[model samples]
Target: MKISTFISTLALTLLMLIPFNSNAQEFPDLDKSPMDAAAFPSKYDEPKKLIKIIYSRPQLKGRSIWDLAPVGKVWRTGANEAAELTIYTPMLFGDTKIEPGTYTFFMIPGKQEWTAIISKDLNVWGSYFYNEENDVAKVAVPVKNDKNNSIEAFSIVFQETSKGTDMYLGWGHIRLAIPFHKL
Candidate 1:
């Protein structure tokens, strides 16, 4: 009886030594620049999607837009990763036609304008590996300053137009609209 009691006590002690929830994992904190997506339809349950963009939203955090994205330089167009633009249907950026596929999006911020670039490169981390030779389409989009409302974080939104859709990029006091006409 004593031997059985000792065995039971030892088993209980061993069980206590082992973690009760060994499967529990330690998750990291939220990212400073969170991933976001903007679709043309905007609706969650929309069946057909004309275009979608996956990007990381980076906040200004009291930083200047010129400092964050310097003029005459290629920016990732977001935070960590270069924005990914998925075109469901063929669209025209200027005279250049972009086919239905996923492409890396980049930008060259300027004082009065910004050049939007859609490259063939995939899985790119940032503009560090951006190659101009892989550019599928490039368009010069005029920048508009919003004096009244200054956006803190980088944001992208789509607005329907009679031609197609306007993809607006807003950050700080700068705003740009790249028109993608249906082709």
Candidate 2:
């Protein structure tokens, strides 16, 4: 009776260990999912210019406006919710002045010059049905490549400077820089 009880206990322990051991294995197929925009923390406060750009993934895959995007094409830029971009203070991009307000961000990716359009419309999806006539400001910015690329997800980073701020968009091997001065 003692030997039989010991065998039963050992069998129960092995049954429990099987599920735990299989859980340790990694599944690459499970890694595909839409990234949460809230994962990127916001740094907004008074006095300083606060620009918050919110993006989402409506589809299974992600959206891109590059070689994935075509030249002379209008991209929704982001998923649902119009890819909202809120500016706290007045800012100047080239000669164009962007007031402190929320606006929908759209992009026209090209081989030579990528056009960044700030539209009065703040709510939209993919730019499949974007109206260029509603653009508040359109600025042409050059795209450059970085040697040491590490950023995997699409991101926008702001670097404060003495004059103003430098907004950078990093994705894959491309890094585009845009300077803005306070108005």
Candidate 3:
């Protein structure tokens, strides 16, 4: 009975979250990062779809996102709802092993490196409810700066490297790549 009750409550909570995420888009006109960016899935012409990251893209409308997303803080990894990463196969994310599943993605930004977290918690609006105990894997990745150019909107793009896929989280003028390979 408890299991059934838990499932029902979980379902309702997810339902309520969608509306709040929409409400997050209702920012003032002068506000930067106004677009509640949501990235859809795109498949590469490979064996099958490998990984999918779902998150919103907030643009840097001439204002520095650094004011909103400072160093040494936990970013929701995107706007609105929490960013989610879905792995289709067994793989290695840095030194951590990740099996096929979906998990909430979070990041703690620092001056030199960023800590990437794959958390068990779901349906979270942002880092507001982030719990370290629920983390499945956490690894530090060095920051990559594109000094010559700046990204207007936050984006997640996959680059097929020689070893595996390099997942890049680009925002403002910063980009961090997390490498993952099939086992």
Candidate 4:
């Protein structure tokens, strides 16, 4: 009986060791444009989150900013999908009050200024389907050049200021800050 039981155990172990032709999930390689998120009160221990944004970072692989995002055209604000912005509290976007909610972020790039639009649309792939009717808030922010701080990857960061918070977008040598004043 003991010899038979040992043989059975050995056989089970060998079977487990043998690789089978099962349908294993194959995860693809890393994304060329990786998804990222930024939030106000950036610390993890912060109890309240004022605002947050989910976007993709597209690198400038020997491509100019105009190549990826054309001038005087609506951009999804990122690479893969339209940037998603969640406002936790009512905030004033250049006198236009924006309520606490999630919205799609889009931008129409220009040489002097950029029109930042907050739309009611959500889960959109790109600005290809952008509709003007869905825009809830639109603000024209002047483009600032920071030749010293040339950023290769598209990035959005929130910085606390005396007025309120500034959501700054940097790429190449261009920088734009969208102010969110406290209500």
Best by TM-score: 1
lDDT (tens digit, per residue) of candidate 3 on 93-123: 8777888888999988887899988998888
What is the full ranking by TM-score, best candidate first?
1, 4, 3, 2
List clashing residue pairs in candidate 3.
37-56, 37-57
lDDT of 4 by residue, 1-183 (tens): 699999999999999999996768788999999999998978363568888899999999889999899999999999999999999889998778999999999999999999999999999998999999999989999999997889989999999988779999999999999998887
What are the lDDT figures for the candidates, one per model?
Answer: 0.93, 0.67, 0.78, 0.92
| lDDT (Cα, tens digit) per residue for candidate 1, span 120-171 | 9999998999999999989998999989999988999999999899999999
Q: CA RMSD for every model?
A: 1.8, 7.7, 14.4, 3.4
Name the 10 consecutive residues with the lowest summed lDDT in model 1: 40-49
Taking the tens digit of each residue's C-alpha lDDT, what string does model 2 give over 1-183?
Answer: 699999999999998877656478766663232433321124535454456676653332345445445679876554444567777778886788888898887777776667888888866766766888888888888988776874556566777766677677666666776667777
What's the alpha carbon RMSD for model 3? Answer: 14.4
In candidate 1, stretches whose alpha carbon ends up further than 4 angstroms from where it belongs are 2-5, 17-23, 43-46
What residue pairs are clashing in model 1?
Answer: none
Query: What are the models' TM-scores?
Result: 0.93, 0.68, 0.74, 0.87
RMSD of 2: 7.7
| Backbone clashes, candidate 1 | 0
Candidate 4 has a TM-score of 0.87
**Model 1 error, position 63 (Å):** 0.6
Q: Which regions in candidate 2 have their CA more than 4 angstroms from the true location?
A: 1-47, 57-67
Where is model 4 more than 4 Å wrong at Cα? 1-23, 43-46
